[model samples]
Target chain A: MSDAMVLDGARAEGLATVREVPAPGLIALKGDLGAPALADAVRAVTGCAVPGLRRIEAAGAARAGWMAPDELLLVAPREAVPGALSTLEARLAAAHHLAADVSDMRAVFRLEGQGAREVLAKLAPVDLAPGAFEPGELRRTRLAQVPAAFWMEQGGFTLVCFRSVARYAFDLLAGAAAPGGEVGHFA
Target chain B: MLLLTCPHCGIDADETELSPGGEAHLTRHGPGATDEDVEAYLFLRDNPRGVHLERWRHANGCGKWFVAARCTVTLEVFGTYPAQTARPPQHVLDAIEAKRPGATRKLPVMEGAR
Candidate 1:
């Protein structure tokens, strides 16, 4: 994340705040994981149980989002990734799986404030109404033209897109968040 | 806008999020096959007017290929299943037949699948 970031202190002042945030560690677990054994390994690593489809589970600072049927994106601090990978590797040795460290491959941003929901609604196609997209739900969909995923976090959302398109994504978000008429659809 | 569920990820995906793969349930025309078989495999396709089985990839979402049973004229998608199936599942066929009688009548290209 430190190597290729174009937005280090980027932030937008509006009813919604779109600011670049330091990346927590990101790990991708993809495979045919058998129950109990693999589930235990995941819980042991992230402090959160394997989430159901399109859900994000959190325990303390660690989070695990179900990215696909066979994939879970785990989040930990930067220092904890190596240890987590080793633990997962040892437990899943006989199991067919891939545990990869992808902390640096992403550009993460936090969209918060009174206008946060409208900012997201402008960019993403998902329904962001209160009951429709509440806290703890994870959605992997496109942000404008780029592939992105965002999850509800209390009053706001934390979004992630590929590092290669961070600038473009930031521009899109900031532009939508610029001082303007309020959609208030989610408000 | 055609909406299809990704059978693998269990998400309702918009057509913009999906890449349409023309037809589904095609058998290969690999080695040891005659010219007619190869020609049919390479060129022939079922352009049925209704109750069609087609392939779709969830490009922006789960990134998995899925088969969709749909009505070509009405664009009413009956069901979606995984792409790993060599032929449309019985339930999907039944769903199609339920809406359009004799809808499972196979094309020449699909007969070998059964």
Candidate 2:
């Protein structure tokens, strides 16, 4: 099989740096996420605990975040996705849950630097105030008109949107990240 | 744009992240209900000019359904609550009462109904 490609090209020219992470392993897990068996199974596979509502937990390079009351998104290094998914599926076979690999179903991008939050505020409607959305927090919200996910890390923020609209999301981010596109003071 | 706080995720979601679910706290009419009752349940709705209650889903956020009490004309939101409950909570009712005195506490009855 041919090697999979990553959406890595971006044109960020301002304080914001927009670029794709390139082929991170993504797994969608749905079930009683609070259940002991499911939580243990997920921890076993990802080496992290199931995050609380709107929270993300990370161990090494793998991270798990709550998507809904019963759903979660597991992100790991690209090379480790397939193995991690199989291990989760096998471990949670008897549990009332679903574990599926969704690495290619969505594209992940990291938007950081000085005005990352400001650039994102132009599209997403949720409050990006430091106190409201701190580090380790994730939200399933919209970017402009498309459905997407947002999470904060050490230096910047990460955005995950459907692969179908990756271009639109990229362009929007690039435009917002341009020199004159500073949010609330655009010229 | 309207902004609603999702009871599930505690996020103040904008109208873009929310989907309107029509009127809230409607009685369900199933297989055993009378014909008129079923008709009222399905077709009848109270589009009051003030102090209206609505159902809204956080479509892009937590994906949980919630209820909101707001003014139809002024667009002032009283409060939001979880959808698992059959009716609006006491705090919401209190807020409405505080805003508009003598507002009807019960659901509006259909015309020509006993």
Winner by TM-score: 1
lDDT of each: 0.85, 0.82
Can you tell me which runs of candidate 1 are displaced by over 4 Å?
A: A4-6, B107-114
lDDT tens digits, residues B25-76, model 1?
A: 7778899999999998899887988778889998888778999989899999
- The local lDDT score (0 to 100) that residue A84 gets in candidate 2 is 81
Report how far residue B75 has shifted in candidate 2, in Å.
Answer: 2.1
Q: Under CAPRI classification, how is model 1 graded?
A: medium
Candidate 1 lDDT, A45-127, residue by residue in tens: 99898888788999989999988888889999889999999999998998889999988899899999998888888887777
Which residue pairs come into collision in candidate 1? none
Please report how far candidate 2 places residue A48 from its true position, in Å: 1.4
Question: What is the C-alpha lDDT profile of model 2 across A75-186, one tens digit per residue?
Answer: 8887887788778778787888888888888877889888888888777886776677778898899888889998888788888888888888888888878887655532
- Candidate 2, CAPRI quality class derived from DockQ: medium
Error of 2 at A32 (Å): 1.7
Candidate 2 per-residue lDDT, tens place, B61-108, comes to 878999988899999999999999876677877788898985635545
Please give the RMSD to the true structure for each candidate, in Å. 2.0, 3.4
